[model samples]
Target chain A: MVHALGEIHRVLASGGVLIDLRPLCDRWSIEVFSARETRHTGHITDLPPGLEDDTAANRAMHQAEINGWFIREKEAFFPLHYVWDTASDMEKWIDEEWVDFVGLDEETRRATRSTWALGDADSRVRVKVKMLLTRYRAIK
Target chain B: MSARKDPEGNETKHLHQFADFAGKRVLEIGCGEGRLTWRYASASALTVGLDPDKNALRVARIDRPSDLADKVHFINSHAETIPFHKETFDIALLAWSL
Candidate 1:
């Protein structure tokens, strides 16, 4: 979160306006994703089926938390947008689905640039989705 | 369940500690999920909740209390790049986010 805020500060003009949102005790329930429509889903392969990572949302809120350096704006209430048209469109959940995090036995870890690579690269899949939209702002 | 995390479950008691929010602009840093945003908004302050985790913010926005919707602002931005200038807010509340 701190790394994200530094980027925002880099671009924001001095004395800019910022509105932020933070969660105290919150958890997210990701809707599951699969290549097939509930075909008795199972961990057939080490790789997850699709792409899911909401880095953009994290960047936004992280910037908001550092409002101490900026001029605070009128506090407004905005909710996150959680509805995506389809399952494949939900990108936030893709990382957990696609990445095979199993510990490398030995030779496999040295064979590739990523320690999390799948045992069978042929079965790997990558997909994107918009799981949610959060509200945040920092204006110069 | 949301109200349970309040500094004190009782609104009146928490309000006493948060009296700085009265008619002031408030920025809540590290609001895990805006559980307090709902209460602070109802207490007569314009409050904003700032969190970096989108997964958590997703639920915060989904279940925000409807009654205080107009009084608060939920932003997906970070604590540093807040859209405002320095010294702009009357009060900044960070509940155990150190």
Candidate 2:
């Protein structure tokens, strides 16, 4: 990650800005059933069952570690909600995009399907993703 | 289960607050399918979208709007080894790349 930052620093011109947007380490949590239900039940804090590396934590640590190379000018948190047309779509995304994570078991999938079912019998799942937006200036 | 709607234009809204691309040369690394390119390409003087994924670049090229044909250019490249010369672009945007 530091190497990538160095490459970015190298490519940036003087006074150039680097917009580093990534998932915040400790801020990531999944609310599987429903917004209200998840809110009342509390978010799942544990890392997904099969993830080998702590990506969010590593990203946070990387940001701290690379602070010296670039000067942070602004920072904010953004909420990104990834909504799927159906529970199957959500499962496909998890299977393909999030191959590293393994906690999406049958029980969770079933709950998501049921929770996202519409009155008209439509099924749509929404996943909440938290992103950290940081703007940095390359230190000459 | 209840139906849910996808979030609308949140990224663009956030991006507008952070930087202005007017008349600036922009280089977007890891630009998958040019999702954000079309949003700012018109405002930017010149926009170059680069990604290592050939398939994604192909999709981006096919989807390129006629108005932005001259303004935006898609290239296949990696972030670690950018092909352009030093100081080529005024603003380098990674957007969700990193």
What lDDT does each candidate get?
0.43, 0.67
TM-score of model 2 relative to the true fold?
A: 0.78
| Interface RMSD score of each model | 12.2, 3.9
User: Model 2, DockQ value?
Assistant: 0.45
TM-score for candidate 2 (chain B): 0.89
For candidate 1, the docking band is incorrect
Question: Stretches of candidate 2 above 4 Å error?
Answer: A24-68, A118-123, B1-6
Steric collisions counted per model: 65, 4
Task: Give, for candidate 1 chain A, the lowest lDDT window spanning 10 residues.
Answer: A38-47
Q: Compute the lDDT of residue A13 as modeled in candidate 1.
A: 40
Clashing pairs in 2: A25-A56, A116-B1, A117-B1, A117-B2
Error of 2 at B73 (Å): 1.3
